[model samples]
Target: MLFKKLYTKSLFRICPKILSISSLRYATAPSSYAETVDLAYSSYESTEDETSVRPPVVILHGLLGSKNNWNSMSKAIHKSTGRKVISIDARNHGDSKHSSQHTYLHMAQDVIKLLKKLEISKVSLLGHSMGGRTAMVLSLLSSDLVSSLIVVDISPAKTSPQIFSMVNLFDAMAAVSLRSGIAMSKARKLADEQLKAVIPDINLRNFLITNLIQTNTGSYSWRVNIPALKENFQQNIASFPSSLKGLQYCGPTLFIGGSLSDYIGKNDLPEIQEYFPLAQLQFVDGAGHWVHSQKPEKFLEIACSFLKDK
Candidate 1:
């Protein structure tokens, strides 16, 4: 129901599928947003008319989140900025194909392949948490592909203690046995109940439970690759690559942090500015790592203002 509500109101009905070791192709493109970029103005009202074609905005969701996480905001952003919006399902999450190797580089390349398949030469990127890191890496690796960037509640430096703490959450989820033949609703309840043993926060459990999907054979399973995530979380996901230290993306970048979240510290500013000298930072009060969802209006206002100039 959580995703259903978001999808009903979202302007985008289809999302790009990312594959590994295979050709990039649309999973199901018929009767969707495949044929037209200029037709995105039906429900969304364009505020500005530009003589030059503006780059499309490609939105990336965080760990354990799908493109639908940003669907609500995508509509508003397209309405405000008058640009095409493309929300993606990163590999191992959502509708994308899963892979054993999940790292920033691998994820960035998946996005690049999708962009190349779509023939998008230049793009504006909006990403959150893990996806934010992917955006930063992509910007640094292919500076010409990215025109502008918006990173929400994440840093380019080493992972914070809060992110490390997520290891326990993943461990707890892995211990849960959805088993076969259980109804999807019952499986969700069981997963939530079991997860509450280690993670007391019902809100967090419910958020994670949205990843549950019913298999074709009347079985329940999580869409995200838990075993792979567990194997690579600490070394790969939790730590930023040192090899990318000296590299930088000089494109216009905006970093938005949540005041209530410890993901971005006061000390990380120098490193961020070093990698992105043209970077700008903004914070929303009473919000956590999911700043865009927590404070949609303010995040949108600030984001739209930044994209307006770019």
Candidate 2:
């Protein structure tokens, strides 16, 4: 399908399809997002306004998360604004393509391919954690495709290496031996035990365990490329390419950080300004790294008001 406007009366309903490839397994969703069927990605579109020509807004989730991760926020945003919203499954995490290598460049390209397939000329972007980095790179890689950008609790500066100690949590979970006949409940219990010390939130623990899937052979395994993620963990926290040195996105951008999260601090503000000179910064009180999920109402308020403003 070429570039065109979608009516509010038509709600996109994607039907799930399972596909097997030599490289990886995929669950494809079919609907109106894009006409192309072979692309390995999933999307949820929610629209409200019938006459408004609001630019498409795409939401990208963090590492180890799928498009479903933004189900709540995407629905909320769609209900609040009559504009189209798309939540995408980034590569290696969700139903998207799973490769042995994970890098910001490759992830950003996956999003770009999705947008191209949708024939989206321009879009507003909101990303969390690793997703935030992808959005930042997207703006640099395909500036014209991005109308506005929102980076949640992340900056271009190199993040502290110590933060990735959490990978041990994944290691611990992988260490748990389970057969194909084992139930998810048992797998959940084992993963919880491994992650209990690191993740205090039961809900978050469950969210991570959702990546664990039952294989066709009845074996339980993680959907994510754990070894690839482990190897690229440092690159995930590393700075952007030097070619992006002088690149500055002048769009209506917002940089949101958590009050309790050290990921984005006053020290990182200058570097952020250097890269995103037009960015507006807001720090959410009583929130941490997961600022948007932690303070949805405030995040929505800020986002809505910003988008509405000329």
Candidate 3:
């Protein structure tokens, strides 16, 4: 399903003129509004078929997650399907270029560019959390490029209300100060200790600490652009963009929800079907929002099954 280009130019909204500035001073809105960044990616080649012309599966990681998080999963998917798997770090996350704009439009465009760079005309997208939303937008706007989609623990509608509380997590992360020469182990422990007041969940803290890196300067720092992510969280992370209202993707799609997660529910079916008429929904029992991590075997089973079918 190689889709023709839906649009040639990035969508841009003109800023209203400032009354006192001039009669009607206006140029195109700043490029930052829809800027695209070169994403960092890791490719896991298929072991079974070096010459298979099948479309590869592209995994998009979630908020605060990097391609590194999916390394094992990528290898597993490739091993299972004998199809190449490529995972990417979205803008402002992981090793991707940092920018002030972290909206779905900008992110989708980034993926489009990355695909073009790799000469991939069609792909299967597997996304988790924030990445799921990005995949949704890309599929909606460019259906031809998507062969199938697997969304993990999220919906196209508004996200869970609990996501808004992430502001405290970002604040807690921002409050930490790792001095130069801090050991990676000590930095993680110290970060965990400092975050205890705001984030009491040990598992959650450990997951977030995965983003922590020991810099060449011998100092520990977060590679993710926290301030940029924080600025876009309340709106971007909490809900899907309205600008994509009328667009729909007609490709095979699967919505995988964790039974214990509120991120996706029956209430979201209508909204999802509106955009993806062929979409299917499945919930992994006993799994939470981070279903893939919490239940790797089930997640992989379901994902591989879906991939095999469509």
lDDT of 2 by residue, 66-93 (tens): 7877888887776666567788877677
Q: Which candidate do you rate higher for lDDT, 2 or 3? A: 3
lDDT of 3 at 237: 68
Cα lDDT tens digits for candidate 3, 1-310? 1111111122133322122222112112213456688999999984575325678999999988899999999999988887889999999888899998888878888998899998899999999999999898788766788999988889977678888898888888999888889678888889999989998899989888998988787988898899999999887767887656656676778888887889988677777876676677888878889988888888898899888777
Off by over 4 Å in 3: 1-33
For model 1 the TM-score comes to: 0.82
Every model's TM-score: 0.82, 0.81, 0.88
Per-residue lDDT tens digits of candidate 1, residues 1-310?
1110100111122222223221212212211312211111112225463324888888888888887667789888988888878888887888888778788777777787777777879989889999999898788767789999999889986476878778787788778887889777889889988998898888789889988888888777788888888888988888765556556677778888888888886567777866777677777877888888888888898889988888
For lDDT, the strongest prediction is 3
In model 1, what lDDT does residue 114 have? 78
Better of 1 and 3 by lDDT: 3
Winning model by TM-score? 3
CA RMSD of all predictions: 10.9, 11.8, 8.7
